[model samples]
Target: MIRTRTQAFRLTLGTLSFFGATAFAQDSHLPEIQVRGPRDATIGTADSASEGAAERESFQSRPKLRPGDIVEAVPGVVATQHSGDGKANQYFLRGFNLDHGTDFAVSVDGMPVNMPTHGHGQGYADLNFLIPELVSGVRYRKGPYFAEGGDFSLAGSASLDYFSALPAPFVDITYGSNNFRRALAAGSRTVGDQTWLGAIEIEGNDGPWDVPENLKKANAVLRYSQGSPNRGFSITGMAYKSRWTSTDQVPERLIASGQLPRFGSLNPTDGGNTQRLSLSGKWFDKGPEGETTISAYAIDYQFDLFSDFTYFLNNPVNGDQFEQTDRRRVFGAQAARTMPTKFGALDGVLSFGAQWRGDRIGEVGLYNTENRERLSTVRNDKVQQDLYSVYGQQLVYFSDRLRGYAGLRGDMLRYDVQGREPVYGALNSGRGHDAIVSPKAGLAFTLTPQHELYLNAGTGFHSNDVRGATISTDPASGLPADRVPALVKGRGAEVGWRFQPNEDLTATVALWQLKLDSELVYVGDAGSTEPGRASSRRGVEATLRWKLDRAWRLELDGALSRARFRGLAPEGEGNYVDNAVERVFAAGVTYIDGPWTASLRLRYLGPRALDTQNTVRSRSTMLLNFGGRYAVNKHLTLGLDVFNIAGKKGNDIEYYYASCTGGEVVSGACNGGVNDRHVHPMEPRSARLSARWTF
Candidate 1:
């Protein structure tokens, strides 16, 4: 295994080196595009009012503490962390917690980032490898109305694109409170008909915790490309590795009783390490016949994580610390074509696509551990999962004032599992396959050149973890286990309005609802599936953006939602869905004058029920952040960012669960662990200063 990984690394490096050397021999120049405000000008061009894009300018002036926070640019999305910076972020959108990106899809440069049947969680998306400086734009959509989206796109999706070329080469260095340090170098150059872009990043941080979350990271990207948006080909290579000590959420009672600090951890040995290497390429062509695109990718990924969420709840003497391991190789390919055609006397455009993905997991396991040392294996298995999809859509221009589209998509999933443990191996090993078909439709009416109304409806589905679909018996105990369906179905609909009264102002409002057949999900932390009730969610969202002259811009957005389980509930259990956020609001003001730029943003998260009974609720949180930058010269710039400007004392996340501290244990067992709120506190006020040199 070691030799194989080493060879793969060498091959990737050699390919990048060869491309870089070849591109340095020729020279050409291309002008760069001017980036605009926080939101893209998508009035008449948008398929739905809830879909929009954010340009590079929108990200550069924001006070973001992590790369995943870039997704927050979407109207109602929120990104927060409950563990170390190296772990995947927790996300919330449209009344869904979207734990580790389960129902929300995210991709970078056409390469999928979500991991299926992962060790930590299904659809685990870790953006720690992303270098924010290389991003060009983020295009986002809400609801399941697009035919091209598959898998985890039931709630929403976002696609991030990288700039094909940079106006100038640059280097950035930054230092902040809590021992945060970072450095990044990136550049792009055109040689003959091809362009080469490269970047490297290094960062370290010791968070303000009693355990001191020590984080170290290194990342690099290399790309070779030729052509424009209309016709082009490009290839990219990425490598990243990170390790960190985590400070997971702790029982709030401990802090209340002065037994532990708000930032203290019950187990200091909990941490994780991860590595990812990938190579991807894309080819595009446009002609009188149509426009076509083809893309393919291969990725190598590995992760090892140790966590102790319950402390001594499970094992009094050895503690509850355990480890999750995942190592896999992923391969995928996609092809699409769009063509203009005439349906009788009507003019329309037809788009069709096909996709294939396969995951070859060498080992995905759960093990009991003490002080990060493995004690005994609970379950160990190897899995192979493959997915195939095809979709087609037709957009018809019924008339100058009305346009509509209809689409159909089909997907098939197949998996094979092999248990490596001695006792549970035979009982858990199995093979399974499933298929699904979804329909999508949308209608838009142009009330005027500046106003539009839209109605969209779609069906979508997400696959369950293969282990959950094939498990016949419990690995830890000899109890029979019921298998969950390989795929869960969902339906959603939305009505929206978009108004662009003038070039300087744009506004949008949307009402949407979604229903899922079942919420049954695999619990990666426990190596088992948790049965869930069917659920429904409905929400309203609004966004407004106005340019108060060319130097100033104002943005405001908010969402209100309600989520509940369907049908009858248990006697004492209410219909409320735990942790389903009900309200979110954000506002920002940006100012740019001459060579100076500044922005201030406010974010609010409303309180929500912590359990089904609604007997206990969580506290609302609000925060303010500020950022400013000054151009020293054409080639130099300095910037400052301050987070939690109000010094708010609040939690990033809260959960109600049973856990025990050492003092609560007796005779090698926890006496019915106490059920209490566990919380991870928000970071205090802190600031960072950075300097960038452009050449």
Candidate 2:
């Protein structure tokens, strides 16, 4: 059959790759080629040993909305739902917030995802662009040694590595329900053993949300590698474009009628787009006493968005023309070597890097520009930072039961002001450079061959700009606006235990602590936009994993966090809202039988108090999601997935534009004087059925 030709092509490509590596063996002085793994160049390994096998397989079988769900399985990590699909959610680690998490670093194929201030000012890391099915592997590091400069990361980093190797040719396509669907295709062939790869993927989700809140995206990648364990060079290039909509939630009464989360939804048309490119290099050669390895990478990320935010009185109508963009390029080179020591293996890696960023942000007032009313310019201010850093670590193993590591880093940090646009800064002064040093430490011990325990402690520092930390500023200063927020230092600790009794199962438990010395915080249209120093949180986290005899498997994941303010009060868009303490809990369970997989998810949030004396209470609610899949044959599969199964009572944060109604004076009681507006609420129960085929 004509269709068989494509399958035959894939087989031939795989076969060629299997023999190509061996065919080039005649070159005795070939340069060694190593695809980059997680960039933990900060710490050296315990011993100089052969590198672990490179994993060329994607982490999961599929990545359409229902298939390759970027599942998080680890202790001390929680995913926060941000409306729409869980795919757009954020991850919290070690009691620290990853909404622009500086303490937590995240990169994909070495591309930075965090917004460098500016863009919508609502910019955080958006990891949904790449389908999990495209991922080569993921690296999770906690408690320091990860020097990600954009955001503060005292807790850890989640580095996503994309496929760097390519076979001759391949194609994968899938279709699903709820107007949900996706397609992926790629091919790589060697020109005399110099491999070149190209891939493209597209996905769309009609979503449980109604109307324009739906999401769609397209991604493409091209890569090349040469030399091998011998000599040569390699390069990779990728381009991605995505635009997603967020429909603000509406009252339950509207949703019950099946008209909300869409057109009937409170507010619709909340959306944005993103694009990025990255390159990496490696060269290794045998040395006199030890081996020497050199590596380098350059990454650039850019974001563009047009969002619609909920509004109140005195609110400009153009409802703040939302435009947030970031341009950052970082290049660094690292070298590491291993030498045998009397008591243990001696190893160390040294890395030096330079970071450059350009951000453009502007808010178009909903109010008429013809009205001669100058829309308040929050920040046309552009802040730039120059970063240079060096770090080294030593791994020592005294016995099979005992091993430890210690590392330190030095940084020469500097800053510059490009323009005097409206910006948030500490006190308005444009300080150029700030010097900070951070450190890290860790130890691992094996109680038995099957059990291991580890403790890791690390510290991180964030550079601060005195540009924007206030609300109203005097125009007479004529000084460049301080749009850049202040930076701070974070101290963190992680103690964990893991056991792998057999190949069938594994378990892990851990306790984490993070303390912020002047932790940084920011908000919209509030003030200078400089990070507020009055914020900090502490909590404990844990996780579990079990596989029951292949066909039947079950897993339970949950998180309990006690997060609140250390001691600080700040004003919000509404008087009833401020810097108040709050708690969030997200947990779920999954079961896989035969070709069918079912899962239940639950989210519990603690009671939240109003910022004002009115004392409005935000009640907690639970959401349930279930899905099942059955493979009818070799190339086709049927599936069903649903969200908010029980139709739980959705929650929202309210602000009073009206005054207090009854009760005692200053009671903040809404005795009918409920002058207010509602933000988005949670989604209600909705379902979709899908069918997929891969050839």
Candidate 3:
């Protein structure tokens, strides 16, 4: 068996090398052409009005205390974790608490990272599998004005690209407060016109919570490629696994009554384990007048999570702990072609694309548990979901200073669900199908080389869970329920402007609004879908970047928003959308000179309403961080990172809920009644020291 495994590995490597070499040989004879006007004013796509790019230089200088922090590079986005290091981070953007990436689409190396119809929640995106050192660049776009964006992109999208080759082989070791340790080894080599890159990472951390996170994580990546990102064929393989104990949110009454510490946990057994393995490839060809690109991927993913949100909210005897399990295989492919053309007095580029994705889920289950012991099953079933999309876009230049973009996309989705046991109230075996057509348009007017204005409008949608669309009874309450449509629609519009008065400064401002047809969503915790009223949101964002000198740079970004239900509430209820953020601000300064580099950043999250009545709210939070690096020699470097510089006492997340603790009832039934505040506190001040050696 060992010999056979070795032979298979060798064959895979040989095939990758053969294709890389062929691509290199074909491009080697092409003539070099230099023709440039101004850099592409549009960021990722022609219709994108609020898009930006973060290059390797910014990645290298930023302090990434956690893997998900990398996404903070995008303006007006904030990343925070409410559970453990191994779980997905909570994201907030554009006035919405994205809830683990529900409204934002994320992709890495051309492979979609967001999971639809997940056991935990819809559009669960876990960035823990990423290795910061491997990221080459990140391009972010806010709004659904681009045809290339599909599901979970109503609010925005981010694409993370990895480097095909490293500048040099390197080993890095880091140690920090709270018994944190990490090690990484990465290298790249060129052979016969092909570049092969490999990397491995191991990390462990025991956070500040009383339960001690005890997180362990491992990641590995392998790739072979030739040529640049614009025109190259690359094959990649990745593997990641992690396990950790979580300190879930605690009730405020428990701390106020001295029943538990602020960082204490009601159920110390709460934890999770996850794993992912993927094989993916991308091929692209660029010619004088056109470009063609294709990408394909296959992934195996598994997650097992145990959580106890309400101590005795539902079951006073056994406690309210439960387990969620998901195991699935995902396959997907995309192809696109672009060609430059001209009409009577117009110049333009026409593009056409198609995408297909399918998920085969073997087991998605929810079970009642106590102290990690399963007591009964709530629901268990198998799910199969398929999505297909086709789109066409045209970018026309009426003049050197004016451009217009128009596109249309059509998506078809099918869902199939099979119940494992009827005793658990699982949805009966059934199938559901839906289709949607989205129209997009935009205009960009360049008043001069340094000033521009843009107007965009688009429609988008997010798929509903299959179980929700077919279930006749709630798994937890066992009551008659209403089924939701297979898809929910959203419409949005934006107007923005960009100005660069000189080489030292750039600024952008945008105003946007979005309306959702329905707010219905599957509540994973309750094992049912919650019907909601339609809602509307409007917001403003401003960003500025300034180069103080050759060695210093500064950035500032801010956002403000308002969200409310479109219609009046039934009786005494309010129109406010619960948990919608109202304000956000971020600022950063960096200095790079000689052999030293340093950066400092500050982030703020404003208060939010915790309930539709607007009677309760959460407090705001602010944090500051600092990072510095110094070169000791030609092949060695030393670095330090400090987080929460002010040691602020603030919560990472806050919610309003009801629960019973220690067999005591606080003005309510033993099960649950009155609402109380629940919070997850931010970590105290901490620091990490690192040393790296390169060859």
User: Candidate 1: TM-score?
Assistant: 0.93
Question: Tens digits of per-residue lDDT for model 3 on 1-695?
Answer: 11232232232222212111101111110112101101222321234447766534555678887998899888888999888999888888887777778778888777888888788877889999999887765667788786777888888887776777677799999999999999999988876557888999999999998999999999999987776534667789999999999998888887888888988898999999999999988777766557677778999999998888777767767888899889999999888776765776665667678999999999988889988889988788899999999988777766555667788989999999888857644455678899999998888776666777899999988777778788887766778778777778889999998887675787889999988887643242352235478889999999888888999989899999898888979797788877788999999999999889999999999999888888999999999999999999989999999999999988888877676665465445564444788888988999999999998
Candidate numbers sorted by lDDT from highest down: 1, 3, 2
Q: What's the TM-score of every candidate structure?
A: 0.93, 0.71, 0.92
lDDT of 1 by residue, 383-466 (tens): 999999999888776766677889998999999999998898878899989999999999877787778899999999877888
Q: Which 10 successive residues of model 1 have the least lDDT summed?
A: 18-27
What's model 2's overall lDDT?
0.45
Clashing pairs in 3: none
Clashes of each: 0, 52, 0
Candidate 1: stretches off by over 4 Å: 1-41, 520-531, 666-670
